[model samples]
Target chain A: MSEGTVSGAALRILAAGPGVTIQDAGRHGLLRFGVTGAGPMDPLAFALANKVAQVPDGSAALEISMGGVELEAVDAAITLAIAGGNFRVTLDGQAMPSAARLTLEPGSKLSIKAGEEGAWCYLAPCGRIDIPAQLGSLSTHTRSGIGGLQGRALAAGDVLPLAEPKVLPGGAMEIEAPVLKRPGDVIRVLLGPQDDYFNDAEIAAFLNGPWTVSVRSDRMAYFLDGTPLTHAGGFNIVSDGIAHGGIQVPGEGFPVVLMGDRQPTGGYPKIATIIGVDLGRMAQLRPGSVFRFASVSLEEAVAARRAEAAEVVSGWALAPLVRTSLSSEFLLGCRLVDGWVDALAED
Target chain B: MSKPLIEGAIYDAPRFLNSGETALVVEFGRSVEPEISDRVLSLDAAMTALKLPGVRETVPTYRSLMIHYDPLVIDRATLIAQVEEIASRPGTAGGPASRWVLPCCYDPEYGEDVGEIARMTGLSEEKVVSLHSGATFRVYMYGFAPGFCYLGGLPPELAVSRRTRPRPPHPPNMTLIGGGLAIVTTFSMPTGWWLMGRTPERMFSPQREKAFLVAVGDELKFEPVDRDTFLSLDARAAAGEVVARREALS
Candidate 1:
């Protein structure tokens, strides 16, 4: 349908889980004013969702946490894609893969439930989110109550205005969801500006030992629970600006990895920093998930980041979803021309 | 030209701390002082002037400048080499930038810590207000919260430890002091710093043309106003008017 044919464009939330908020690439160049550029926890997944939805590279999307969301199209049919955590997704009543591109007709309900793996999920629509950009971004910094919908988490009865999707939905398509974590996969980190504060024994213990993601984690930072690390020197440092994934060890001796919504500066001594490409992987590790930090050289970290960027530019491989209900009704409903290619056909 | 002057190069040699693949912290010194702050601001200004590709943003702190960049566009070594070259130049840290006379209301209602502070410092409540308002302060940096201004130059007599227990969330624009730093909070947040008063002028406003009112290295002087005046100015400021008076410092 064309833009005018659809009724008022909006998405009405019937139910929402915690930490659900609108996000874009992030607000940049304002950190000097103490504003944090809060964005999606999983940047790669966010980008993939936008790509699958056929939206512009950095269009705003809903960042749903472990607890999922249930919403309905309000007077407009909209095309969308879900990515990130392997969530259980249902469009109207048909169960679909977590990372699938589909359309929600007017009054159709889309439900995303927490599944077997991952923590953060992305729900991207193929249109500009009709929200006023605060300080040049739609990314929500909930701690400061700035940006997004009233600078807070999305809740039931919230109506988000949506613009007409630039590209129309062609057919149901699916892609492999981002692999947030795998068994034995170590999160890589770079040793710090304040590594000297920790003794050799402490450093070894930190790098060699396992640390569980604490339940106290949020968008700001993830607190690690393990043998509390003591400092060889003072716990506090001269306050300095913090970078995303900077691992600050506080007086309490716990390592807090600052994230997308972290404050601009901090006084705690940072012992290590997670490399850029691995930050998303680290963010997706849910509470109680066990992981170890593996130290990587500066050169290696940069190379890894470059490799990921190249992959993003090359684009993801999309596949057609095949339903296998071998009944007469299911056979009759299948679109013969849609995504139907002979197995032996050559390009 | 005489070899480019190295102004505010407090450190004999700066230290480059790699935060990750995406950022580098050029620390000028180990202490918080005007010279160190000057070095941070000067390097920040130089980085801005150069407009180096891949440099996304630069945050100036008390003794270091954190430069965030896109690693793909510019590698760490190249970025550091360029920054080091700029730091080697003479007179990089320019002089004073601006001065502001911000209106504050120290009426007991807003200045909740006035009595407690006066008792601790062995000064009268009026004396405390005068000492705080009369002193000139410098904008060292912004941190901890959005638009929160961390100012230096608190009078020694007025210096006090942070609250033993953090108070409940206070409203935005509340003037606060802890240790040697004076702050004007941009949003309501629980704080251990003593609330000295409240200001009508918005230190950081997303609605205003400039989101942050003052920049690093600027001078600030608090002009105490009556409660009624504070309410009147607060309303206008809320409506997006720049109520705080400012002037360029020559």
Candidate 2:
């Protein structure tokens, strides 16, 4: 109810994947109440999809994963972009590129298939998806059912209106995908407050093991099957607040990588924390993928994050620009502070 | 209603845990003690007052406090140093907290596990209700679920172990007891804890300007009410009216 934008034309979601939810940045500063910060699994992908759509900063979008989504634009035309996970999209019997910004004419049927690579993809409209904000965000924490289109996943016949619709002069313009890769299955981590809980041998086992992402994975945490980390001391520390990406090793010994919708606090011993820079890279890794961990210092983590932030803003991984049958140019000759098409705008 | 008294400090220096590049945990001790909880709140108060750069938010628990921050704005060393300095300050003591009186209906229809709780505690049903409601509880932490506070201060005589089997899906606002602890859940959750009574009050609602009904360091004393009164209060609560009564603990 405290959302900023007013709704316009509606987007009818005809079908969706398992992990699909509406997400913005996150619901922050509420972890004290045990509310996890639920946002896009891949913040870079979320940001890129918004950039491709050329929507206002912090616009809410639908995140699809595992499977895909089928939707139709009802009553009006709007700009749309599909980014992350390299999903296969088909627009009304015609195969279309997934990451390109395109306009959806009224009654357009768009079907999506899961990406061959990553786990989550973003469906960002040039207009914000109209959903009531819960705790100052549209992001859905599906486990707790706190946010998104009525605090759950979108199914068939969910009519989602645009917060601010851009009239039909929509077109396709693609940006080079930012370099989000970390080369292979290695996940970078910072040694923890509870690293001392485990002896040197346990730490070595953690760094030198081939971990597999379990099927039990969700936005909350990824339960990994790897070398069990034996606690030198008690596995149960006094319960404490969890940082994003904190890894908890319970008495069972297996590590659970806490994700976006993780519990705010826990009693398990955390041996390490994954750096925020590679969280998306880690999230994109599919179940059964060989997961590995590498230790890094706090200074290294911060430096890597700074580099990633620069790539998000300055990287020219944009695909070539084009106008589809229903396309309009939102980036060209507009009041955007930049007011110019990002580099490599063509065709 | 009475509050949990704060005992003297037990630990000399707090233990620090690096939660991540963005967070740090200051732990006073492992066991649950009144003084440890007090120190957690006091350090939380002190840290918030410092307004340390890059410090985003702090979560206070019974034995520790987790500080979430933005590393881009502040370095880890600077944040840790600032927290240590602020924590060691003489004025880092917390102020008194409020006392909240919650209503509980111990009728069998609402409290499906009331008989089970009584059997587990080896007490008669009437005696169980009186003993459970009569005791004053301390708000230790809010976690596992939103607005779900860890209520301590259960008397040893009425203490019992958690159920070997948990309920499939437990409803919210039920006064649950297990492992010598009591909780009035804010939302429906599957729990190993036993449901002794139900209340109509909403401990947390997203619509409210302030979401939490009771914070950590507060006291929650349950007042037994009839099913009719519970129904009326539930209706009033649904209409966005305040039902959980609070008073100064002076």
In candidate 1, what are the lDDT values of residues B1-250, reduced to their tens digit? 0121133345676788878878899988766689888878888999999999999999999889999998889988899899888888885666667889999999999999999999989999999999999988999999988889998888999889888788999988999998767898878999989999999988887777787899889999899999999999999999999898998887
- Distance (Å) between predicted and true CA of A54, model 2? 3.1
- TM agreement with the true structure for every prediction: 0.91, 0.88
Supply DockQ values for each candidate: 0.50, 0.42
lDDT (tens digit, per residue) of candidate 2 on B1-250: 0111233335577776777678878777766777788888888888777787778889998788888888899887787787678667774445447888888898998778778766776878888888878888888888877878888888776678777777777777788887777778878888888888888888887777777888788888888899999999999987877788898885
Candidate with best lDDT: 1
RMSD of every prediction: 5.5, 6.2
Worst 10 residues of 2 chain A by lDDT: A335-344
- lDDT at B193, model 1: 93
lDDT of 2 by residue, A266-320 (tens): 8788889998887888888888989688998888988988887777677645443
Local distance difference test, each candidate: 0.83, 0.77
Candidate 2 ranges with C-alpha deviation above 4 Å:
A1-7, A167-170, A182-184, A321-347, B1-10, B91-95, B112-127
Each prediction's fraction of true contacts recovered: 0.78, 0.71
